[model samples]
Target chain A: MHKVVTVDMEKDILAENRRLADENRALLEEHDIRAFDFLGAIGSGKTLIIEKLVDHLKSKGKESAAIAGDVSGDDDYQRLVAHGIPAANISTGKECHLDAHLVDHALEDLPLDKIDYLFIENVGNLVCPVDFPLGSHVRVVVISVTEGDDMVRKHPAIFAFSDVIVINKIDLAEAMQVDPRILERDARRINPGAKIVKMDARHGNGLDDLISALGL
Target chain B: MHEFSVMSQIIEGLLEESKKWSAVKVEEVFLDLGDFTMLGEEQLKFSYEILSKDTILQGSTLTINHVKGTIECDCGFKGEMSPSEDSPHRIVPILECPKCRGPARIISGRECTIKNLRLVVPDV
Candidate 1:
């Protein structure tokens, strides 16, 4: 005979993750460090924009550190290291997104006081990162022209949730046959007041505007 | 993609809960999934089936109840947004309030939880 049991979990599925994220936010607040989570698809130039931000911050004599999360590669971490600053990598073996627990562990060795800004580059995927918050003061989601115009519309959750939206690789819009305006309109519809930046990070275009928007 | 991890969490919870009654076999798992989370029910079930192998939960039936997305606006608008009619993806086509055209905050339909489980226990 089967004994049916009514297990009233009544628990939020993402509760643990959110609790860890809050802890990370508290730690960052203690050090007075501003953190941003860069989320985007794999080829959306997340690293390049970060490199530009690092360079811009360097010229201002501000120190910044990065935590790079990739599926199983040290490539992005090494690239940030090439900038000659403190950087670390969390290789999520099969996870599509980075959670607060991983970020909390990555923060154990960092010199938080010396860093002015902390950038957590989440594993490249638009969908899974929507619910995982890494305790960022600002959440920036990047979409490149190469990803096509429909990306923002198709993945509405990320665009709607991000604090800032970066449309990267604007220079390739013509070649990729993607109209940047379409993406901008879609983002606006999802989030009326979201700060949208059109960037060509390779040439450092629109970097200043982005910096001003972030107030960095 | 992260459904596997989520399914793993659900199974863990099931194991912990079943221990209280010393269940011998699991029969069915019922879930309440929200429409706003964009979680594919089929994918979640698939993940559950694959991860439950060799465990007590193996071969158990999975039942899901789709919860509708509800929202409230600062403008005093409160209602549920209908899931897209044509999109089999079940995405909420619009996120704004139809009454005021303002951004409506999602108030419900973001949970995925195990409502109950059917278990078989040995008669004393």
Candidate 2:
């Protein structure tokens, strides 16, 4: 079916997505599976962090599967599978992000009962995904220090809506002269309550801290 | 950039409106985005071309109308103006219009919307 969000009906359309997201959130809680969302800019090391997360889970002998929704290839899924984790690639075709309905559809094809952790890696884009809730129990926004500290002011929604702030690429904080102190201030200024985890996903630095923060 | 989300909504909205009409397909999407909405024509066109494929909104033409942004000034003046380039921000005449020399008020911009869809029914 073709769906249109006309100007006159935009409110109703958004309300519907919100309602579905809430229901999905409740369902996740019922299953005792904490869903954590990883959102970030185009090259903010989100993919690497997600990959590290799968490995971390396996190192501890936990069962975790991923639902990677991308606009392009299934490289992310393969990356997870190579780590001894099962993953589902939800190719959006043309959409920038994934919604509850799409995630629900993909989950039907997976062994929901066998998996203890359901990690949904959203598309790399930051703007559209903010509005769509994919039933995640926690929403973490990852930012690369190279993207500039002003990102907090440029797109406050990502920082504001996030439950945890993962400051990736801390290793380049010196080479890139990216100051965590300023980003930290800006991040906290927008979302004072969100736990900020600084890390270099590529170097494996701070991954353990992130895992501990997630209580995994 | 955000057109895909808006287009996705437009597609969903069109499907929903189609149910109301006996029309089997839509001919044109009459979208009246709010004047305050900052939608690029090229982006919408691109998203529609891709998203409308194999859907009810396929082959449908999109008609867009640009409306003026509204502004209200503290000096008891109200008017409308286009958002500044790149900034997409505006301030009520900090003092007054350079020409009219009066405080200006802004009321709109930053609106994203799809107004209506025109559908065609099969002629039996």
> How high is the CA lDDT of each candidate model?
0.85, 0.70
* Per-residue accuracy of model 1 over B1-124 as CA lDDT, tens digit each: 7888888888888888777778877888889887767578889999989988988889999899988778777888888754444355656535566667677677777778788888887566
Off by over 4 Å in 1: A1-3, B82-89, B122-124
Residues A46-140, model 2: lDDT tens digits:
77888888777777777787888789899877887787767788998888878888887777766766677878888887667765677788888
Displacement of the residue A137 alpha carbon in candidate 2, Å: 0.6
True contacts kept of each: 0.36, 0.11
lDDT of 1 at A137: 91
Per-model TM-score (chain A alone): 0.96, 0.89
Q: Write the per-residue lDDT of candidate 1 for residues A1-216, one digit (tens) a residue.
A: 555555556655776788899999999999989999999999899998888889889999999999999999899999998998899899999899999999999999788989989989999998898877889899999999999988887888888678799999999999999999999988876676579999998898988889988888
Reference-based lDDT, residue A150, model 1: 82
The root-mean-square deviation over C-alpha atoms between each candidate and the true structure, in angstroms, is: 2.2, 9.0
In terms of lDDT, model 1 sits at 0.85
